[model samples]
Target: MTIPKRMWWQNSSVYQIYPASFKDSNGDGVGDIPGIISELDYIQSIGVDVIWICPMYDSPQVDMGYDVRDYEDVYRPYGTVQDMEVLIEQTHARGMKIILDLVVNHTSDQHKWFLESRSSKNNPKRDWYIWRPARYVDGQRKPPNNWIGNFGGSCWEWDEHTQEYYLHLFCPEQPDLNWENSATRQAIYDSAMEFWLQRGVDGFRVDTVNMYSKGDMVDAPITDPKSEWQFAGFQYCNGPRMHEFLSEMNQVLQKYDAMTVGECPHTPDMAKVLKYVSRKEKQLNMVFQFDVVDIGQGPYKFQTTPFNWGLPQFKHAIETTQNLIRGNDGWTTVFLENHDQSRSVSRFTSDAPQHRVAGGKLLSLMMSALSGTMFIYQGQELGMVNFPMEWSMDEYKDVDSSNYYKMVADRSHNDPKEMHVAKTSLQHLARDHARVPMSWSDAPNAGFSAAKPWMRALDDAAICNAKQQQSDKSSVLSFWKRMLQLRKQYSDLFVFGEFDLLDKSNLEVFTFTKTWQNKKALVVLNFTAEEQKLVYPTEVRSQKSELLVSTLDTPASDKLAAYEGRIFMLES
Candidate 1:
């Protein structure tokens, strides 16, 4: 375990805003930069030091904003370049930092580079993207390999005009860049520097950072015989030159006074992660791993199985990651919710009306007290739950969810029971679960827009929203504020402390401690909705404990109420 040196990001709290769902300002039923600007004060009031807005670059919205058509310009619907400039300035003025999404791994087919690459074989940009000749099999043309896209279906998309297949790890419209070419790498790196460095934007949250390079395009040995996607996924992720490419990008990032956190998924190994985020390696400052986040995934990573999980499994994942990164010069980000996953309150905690707030607080305290930077997704502070499971299939907007539904229906031969189970999985794990509009008020469109919202507002917006929570002292929002305040007050103990897992085999509660120098903080969390006692070891039971913070107003003797979490400063 490597201890991380003091850095700006280590002390900062990040709030991720899915731009389209955050707020729609122009009455176009879409959120924009101006809309984000309007909520700057509210974001600042929430105590997050940094705002990580999802990709807002010029795009056709094929994969939302991840499929970038123009790297230097902003999406017209969201705003113009000048609007982004103003937003940055406004964010700085309010003493908060803002980071844009860096999506260089792929570009929309409509992008000039892709268009030129596919225009003709001899075009100067032909080598800018991955393209291969079709392999004839049994007198029929087929893609060169069996690789599958992360979204669904084959990874290869045939281009009739060019008579070749261009690779896309995601949607067909989003083509992966050919990073093996020096010129292609140089162009992407230069564009990133010109756009953010000149505008004085804080940094970036790199999208699909690990898949820039690819291995030999051959059929992967099937590990999970039942899941072809899983077999192909092994070949498409964490390519051979990932480290070389990231190190080169870091060389450029190091010249600027900024930070970067790569969105590295499917990386279950610590060494693979440390290679990129280690300060000694000069790559990224941190990365978002999916060990705990992908807990209930089915055969393949994207396939969502039933929500069957336990405290022991959850504790092991978190503890193993913490132990691996501890003092190893590698840094990781702690989060329970993000744009690609369901809300924590809904998926990980008891969202029952009576226990919702406490459950949210328990999750929040567990996240904040972990030995890494804390990322809070929008509406999470308000204890937002998932969209009601009753919403028909038509109400969902995400391409991923729709694709998964079709795949499952086909596999199950349209069996009503199987389709119902698939729909339930979508309700619990779909990316859209976190894509609902930000609930700002009880007013129409949840005060997100005077016009109709692009998506329907949560039915319970009136009960759970920023307006209601900001006014209530015991709201999840308020508790989050206190957590951040304490984090700041005890930076040495919380941000730079050594983490040690306690009662590793405990099945009822998750317990751990963070110690720095002579100070120690013990955190105990009841994983279930029923009261449980923390079985403290003899050494800790003998020591004096001072309550620092808790999810419950009053402790019930030695028993912890459902979803209750407590932090006690130990007197050694």
Candidate 2:
């Protein structure tokens, strides 16, 4: 048998840092590049090879830095461009690569390009953005189309100066850039991507990569009769020119041998996803698929409806995803929690006080054993969980969460019962759950800042903080350290192995096997609070197997403890 060669990214792990909540220096209550530089050693200790920092470019921070005002300059709150250059230098000095968030699909309304584009109808840069005339119905002016934005309201925002409406798929402050123009595409490559690569940046985590090409400007079908605006993903996501533009961007990435992972939402088709990441396509190394995190999301915007999901459904989502990218060339990203998602321990498994540790360990084992590049969001290693349900709407600072709350309040006319229900659902599904400050220690502000943090820390930071867990041998932090070490020790099996999910119908357990050459390993996870005995396959019952790792301290046994996970190496 011939062994296949793997790239640096395929064999490595990525750590995502939402800079604003990571760590704060200068007592500013906001995390900055200098603070990130101070914590490089700590991040290196987790055995991650790449650091994917969210956008720190000049921005109005309307979407927490996703709205880029200047691709070349660092955000004022994050520090200066020199600080970013030092970050790239320090990261490379440690033998680790750093990637920045690329948000070229749109730019902040305050960006010079946008300012010029919206300045006048005959401006040379007018074609840089998507602009259309307003539609007048019954002597009343409405938006160009009935498409709804991701942040709520009509996608078209009227510009008084130009007397035309501009399309913003997200917040109105983030005006979508028109990719149909050759000048726009070239400008993004020169000013956004190559400029960073020249500054020693390794790669990028492209934001909304698939939304670059918008389909025909038309009204979306009204899925809900109650509302006039409709979801526009079908018309805007994964559109006609997506692959063409990605391939063009890939040409720039290829020059520096840079790694690229794209954020592709609303693209549920595996075939379409394969085109974005397949080795033959050469557009992106991998793309984030949201099927798993989106398991319980409702059809409406922001998932305001009640959250309902189970282990079986979750397993099915994973199984389907794992099987689709089975070929040597096709690859995917393995992640449970991110800046846009709630904590995995709280969402996928039990976050009850007694089971939180075990739940965290189980998820760690699952993600480590999966067949892809694993991404660990900051604070995830400490088993950090979501804020308590008692938190009021005022405590939530995420724009999406706030927008959803106001939408629900307006529709229900501020009925106390309706508002209460919305709050309860947001408790489980809001993006703010993941945006809380990282818990570094039990100190005030969770050791994230000397001053009051921009947002509150998790209530249990006293127990879940990294400093508290660092000294304890049995802590989630220690387990994560050990688990990542184990993955590196068996990279051939975990990184290059073939994945096969076993017992697909089982609700309380998730079982799978990874095989590479003559080696085979089995991973069993009990997803419930109660202990359960696993039934092995007939072919494996007689095979000699050695226990490799387990969430529980007890010796290997037939029964699994609550939320327990175990891995074993079976003889080939």
Candidate 3:
């Protein structure tokens, strides 16, 4: 078998930071570039090679910072462009690369291009956005189609000035750009991409990349009969011309030798994903697929009740994704937590006070042993969990969470029982759970800010803060550092080795092996709350093994403790 050539990204691990909740330098209750600069040494200590910062562009904060009003400038609260320059320089000086969030799939309605497009029907920039006349049904004007926005409500927003409706996959304030227009594509390349490359910025984490080339604007098939609108992901996600546009964009990235990881949602077909990352396609270096994270979700993320799922299903998702690039040149990303998803510990394992540390270490061991680039989100190293269930709806600040709650209330005609059910689901699944302020120390506001934070800090910050963990050798944060270091030390065995699944029928334990030539490593993980028997494969039972790391205080002989994970090096 011909092993794929190793690249810098393949062997590197990434640390993702959501700037708003990371730290606050100016005490405005918001994290800024200078705040990130102060923690550079701390991030380096975790042994990450790249830092991926979420969008901080000038915006109205309609969808956090996803709505970009100015591609060339930084948000005033996030410091100036010069501060960004200093961040880039400092990160590189420390031998770590920095990648910015690229959100060109849409622009804020307040952006110059969108403003010009909405000025008049005959404006030159009118073709820059997707606009269509309203459909009159039964003597009443309606949106162009029966499509639902990702957040909620109609996807088409009526514009009073142009007398036409424009499409917004997310919110009305953020309008989708017309990728069919060559001029629009060129402008994004020059302004959003090349501008940063010229400033020594590494690359980007492209947002909703596959949604750039949309199909025909026909009404989506009604999957939920009770709903008025339907999800139009089939019409826009992984559209027909996605590769063509991505290949064109790759031409620009190639000039600077920059790396890219596209965010492709609603994509279940691994073959289609390969086209985006395969070296033969010349598109992107890797892509973030949503299969593993979407396990318990229903048709929509904010369901009244979560779908039933277990470790077996979760393992299948991971194995399927990992095997996608086994013999191919394509690559994938391994991540359990991000800005859009809830905390992995609370969702995947028992998050009780007794099991939280072991649960966090289990996840680190599993992900670090997998094949591909691993990404660690902020606060994950400290085993941060979801917000307390007692938090009221007013405490949840994400736009999606609030919109979903309102939709449920409207549909149920203000039923108090229905409202309570929605709140329960939001407590478990809302994106706001991940947006809580990082616990820096036990100080007021968790040391996130001198003033009140934009969002509440975790209730357990006193125990989960970084300052407390950094001093404790047995803390979850310390385990993460050791696991990352092990991955680097055994790069050939962990990063370039072929993965093989073992005991696929086991429901409580996740067992796998990574083999590179004569070197073999066995990984065992217990996913339940109770102790389980450790049944090793017969072939390796007699072989001498060296213990690399274990979540438990002592290595298990016959039974594994709750959430225990162990990695052993076997002599072939």
C-alpha lDDT of all candidate models, in order: 0.85, 0.89, 0.90
Q: Score candidate 2 by lDDT.
A: 0.89
Cα lDDT tens digits for candidate 3, 1-572: 76656778888899999999999999999988899999999999999999999998999999999999999999999898999999999999999999999999899999999999999999999999999999999999999999999998888999998899999999999999999999999999998999899998888999998999888888999987888889989788988888999999999998988889999888888899998999889999999988898888877876736536877788889887788788888988889999998898988886899999999999999998998888999999889999877888888999999998898888999899999888877877889988999999999999999989899888788888999999999999999999999999998888777888887778899998898899999999999999999888776788787888888778668899999999999987
Question: lDDT score of model 1?
Answer: 0.85
Off by over 4 Å in 1: 1-5, 223-230, 301-305
Clashes of each: 8, 0, 0
TM-score computed on alpha carbons, candidate 2: 0.98
TM-score of each: 0.97, 0.98, 0.98
The ten-residue window of minimal lDDT in model 1 covers 222-231
Clashing pairs in 1: 1-326, 1-327, 1-328, 2-326, 2-327, 2-328, 2-329, 3-327
Q: Find the 10 residues in a row with the least total lDDT in model 3.
A: 302-311
Error of 3 at 129 (Å): 0.6
Off by over 4 Å in 2: 1-4, 301-307
lDDT of 1 by residue, 1-572 (tens): 34445788888999999989998988998999899999999999989999998988899998898999989988898999898889889999998998888999899999999999999999999999999999898999888877768887778899999899999989999999999999999999888555676788788888888888788878766665555443565566688988889888887877776889888876776888888888888889998888788887776544555558777888887876666567677777888889998888888887779888998899888888887888899999999988888999887899998888888788889999989888888888888878889999999888888888888888888888899899899999999999889888988888778888888777778899999888999999998888897667665887789899888777776899999999999999
- Model 1, position 465: C-alpha lDDT score: 86
